[model samples]
Target: MMPLVHSLSADDEIFSVSVSHDGTRVAASYNDAIMIWDTHTGCRTLGPLKGHEYWVWSVAFSPDGRSLASGSSDNTIRIWDTETGTELLEPLNQHTDEVTLVLYSYAGTFLISGSDDHTVNIWDPYTGNLIGPPIDTGDRVSSVAISPDSTKIAIASFNNTLRIYDFATVSPILHDFTIHVCDAATGISIGNPFRGHTNVVTSVAFSPDCRYIASGSDDMMIILWDAVTGQICAEPLAGHSSGISAVVFTSEGSLLVSGSRDHSIKVWDVGAVIRRVELANGSNSIVTQRIDLEITSVMSLKDVVSRLTDWGCTDMSAELDWTSVGDYPISQGGFGDIYRCKLTDGHEVAVKTLRVYVDPDEQTRKSLKHAAREIYTWSKLKHPNVQPLLGLVVFREQVGMLATWEPNGNLPSYIERNRETDRCLLGAQIAEGLAYLHDLGVVHGDLKGVNVLVSKDEIAQLADFGNAVLREYTIQFSKTSTKHNISPRWTAPELFRGSKYSMEADVYALGMV
Candidate 1:
C-alpha cells in the first residue's frame, strides 16, 4: 500500500516502526537513531533520539505511553521517558552482544528482547530489572513476538527453530516446527521441517485470534499452520520474489504483509474470497490489501527464605496500599521483598515484589519466569500441605506473586518456637509432602526450612518452587538451606554428590527428623 504521505524519507531505510497505543505518536528506527513522528500532524519528525552508539534495531512505546525502549547494535537496550526525554535506564548492559530486536507485550507489562548472542531476555521497562533468566536459544534469534494475550511467546532463531513458551510455566511447550501436520480427527501426521524450508525459517507471527501461526522462510514461501493441530493449511502463500525477510498479519486479519530481498512488499489476499455480511452498512462487505512491497526487520527463578538478606520496597507497598498491615519491613533478595497484603476481594495474601539494584535486566527476566512457574505449579498441587496460590500482578516494571497468607509464619520460625518433638513431627509432615510430590513426578530442587510454611492449624505446608524442577531431583543433599533450620544439617551426603538419587533420598534426608 502506498502511503498517503511519506512518513519517512524514501532513502532513509526505516528498519522498524511502532505506533503508540493511542495512535498519536509513532517511533521508527533508522541507522543509529530513533525518530519520533507526530502521526496526526502530517507525519512530521518531532525529534530524533540519539541515545544509541550503534544502529538502532528496534523500538517500542510503553503501554502507558510514558516511555520508550530501543534496542541497538551497541549490545544494549535503553529506556527513555517520552514526556521529558530523560533516560530512565543507562544502556541495559546484560546482553553480551548486539541487541537485535525488542518488543512490548500487549499489556505493556513486560519487554522481550532478542540479541545476536543467541539469547532472549525479558526485562522490566520501568525499573530496568531482568524479568527472568536469559532464555538460551543456542542460535542467534532474529525475531520475537508475544501473543496478543501475552500467554504464549514465539521466537525465531538462526538454528532454524521456532520456540513457543508458555507465559505461565515459562517452559517451552513447543519447539522447532518443521513442516508437520497431525490430523485433527484421525490424528494423522505428515511433512517434515527439512522438506518445507529448503534453507532456513526466518520469520513467524501469530494470527490476531491466535488460531494459526504463519512462518516465512528463506525458501521464498509463507506457510500457514493450524496452531493447535500443527497441520498445514490448503496452500502455501506463494509470490515473494526472493527469500522472505518478515511476515505479519494485518491488524484486521484480512491480509498477510510480507517483505523480502526481492526488494518489494507483497500483500496476500488470505481472507479476501470469504463472504461477509456488513450489518452496519446492511450489505456485503469485501476487504483486501495488496502486498507486493518487501522490506526487512528483525527482533528464572526461584525463591529463597532469608529474611535478613531481603530488602523491602515502599513503591510496591504503596502501589498495593499494604501499609495498613503495620510496620513490616520488606526486604530484597534473589526475589523482591515479601509483603503481606489484602486483596480487593478481602482475601489476605503474601505478595512477593521482585526488584533490581544494579542492572537487573537478566535477573528480572529470570524472576518473572520463576514467578510464573511457581504460580503454575502451586495452582496445580491441590494438597492442604501445599501453600495455596491466589494470583499474581505483573507489569512492565514490576512483578508480584500472591499466595495464601499464613499469619503463623515460616516452618523455621515455628520450629524455633516449639519443642524438639514438635519439630520432629513437622519434619515428617514435610516428608509426606515431598513423598506426594514424588508421586506426582515433581521434584522440589531446593528443599529448605524457609520453603515450608506453617499454617494456623499447625500444619507444615511446602512453599517456594523457584528452584524446583519437574524432572527427577538428582542433586547431592549437601545443598544447604538459606534459612539455618534444616537444609545444611538434614541434607544427605549423596545429594551433595549430585548422584541420581530418588524419592528415597528425600525420605532419607527427612529421616533426620
Candidate 2:
C-alpha cells in the first residue's frame, strides 16, 4: 500500500531515468544532456554530460555501475564513463531517426537501442561497434529491453505491439501487443501479452532474476508482470499523474524506479507490491510449500493423490475400472509407456504409466512428481482441441494417466494416411489449443506433431503433457522434469542455452509442427 520510497523533482520534463546497479546514483535524460544524481541525497553527482545535438530521450547504467549509455533525437547513442563524467567512445551513429530507448543487458555484454526509424540495433558496449544487423520492426520503436539471460530482445513500437527477437540470430520470432514476454533466443511469444495498460506502453524492464517485468505506459500506470506466466503480479501502481516515460528495476530487483513526463521520478518498493499480492491471493505461500514438498520429500502414491486433490483434481475418485488390451505397450513416452485400454464403461482410453523404479531413488521420485504435475495441468484444461484427461488408474503398482483414445492416432500417422485432409484446418486447431493453454498460463513444453492426436472427426487434439508445465508454479517445478531430453527439432534455441521452458518456447515448437 505504501510502496513509494522517493520522489525527486527535475527542472525539465524527464524523458528517461536509470538507476545504478548499486542503487546509489540515478541518471536522467534532460534536454540534450544527461544528469547524474545521488539517489539518497537527491544531489547532482555528475553530468550535464553533454554530447547530443538534440533532445536526449533515454539513458541506462551499465551493470557494473561504471558506465552510462544515452540515446537522443540526434540519432546517436553515447556511452559515458560514470566516474570521470567523460564520453567513453565516439557516438554510436547507426540509426536514421531519433533514438527512443537505450538499454544494457544484465551481464553488460551488449547494449540495445530502439529508434524512430523503426529499427532495433545491438551494439558492443565496449567497442562502440554494432554487433549485428539492425532489426526492422516496421513501426517507430518506443522502447526496448533485454532479458536478464541476454538471449532475447523485446521491442515496443508506436504500433502498440511488442516484437521479440533472438539475440544470437537477430531474427524475429514473435509479435504481439499490449506488452508481452518473449523468448530472447527464438523471438517466440512467451505467453499471452500483459493487457492492463490503456495507452501506449513507453518502457519495460525485466527484473534481475527474470521473474518479473515492469512496464510503464502513457496512461500513467505501471504494471508488474510475472514474466513466466504473463500474469499481472500486482495491482497497477498509479502514483504518476502524467505519462510515464521510463521504468527500471534496481540490480537487486527489490526496488523499481519510474520517470514521468511530469518532471518527477518515483521509486517503489518491489517487495511491498509482491507482499500485497500474496496477502490478497493467499496462494503464493501455498505454492511455495507444495514445491518444497515435491523437492525435499520422497512422495508416495497416496501423497501424490493428496497433492492432486489439493490442486482440484477431485475426479481421481471416479470408479472406472480399466485394463490394458494387450501384453505390450502401444507406444513409449518420455517418462512412461502408453497402453491401449478398455474402461468398465466399455469406452476405450490410452493409459500412460510412469516407469517407477522399485528402489525409489531421487530420480524416480522426480519422475513421479513430474507425472503428478502433468496430471494436475491436464485435468484443468477443457478445450475441444486439447486432449481430455479421463482419470487415473493404477497399473502394475504404478499410477497411470487416462485419456480418451483417438482412433486416428497421432497427427503424423493420420496425415500420412489422409493425404487429402485439410492441413490448414488442423494447424488452426492446434494453434487454438496452444492459445487456450497459454491463456490458462500453461506451457506445452514438448509440442510436436506426435504429441498431437487426431480423432475420427480429424480434430487435432494436443496430448502428451509429460513435458507440460503450469507457468504459475515456481521455475523449480519445471526444472525437475527431463526438459533436456526434449527433441531439439522442435525446441526453441533459448531452451538449449539453459533458459526455462516457456510459452515462447512452446510457440517456437508450434511453428515447427
lDDT of 2: 0.76
Which candidate number maximizes lDDT?
Answer: 2
How does each model score on TM-score?
0.39, 0.49
User: What's the lDDT for residue 313 in model 1?
Assistant: 14
Root-mean-square deviation of every model? 24.1, 22.5
Backbone clashes in each candidate structure, one number apiece?
A: 40, 3
TM-score (C-alpha) between model 2 and the true structure: 0.49
Residue 447's lDDT in candidate 1: 65
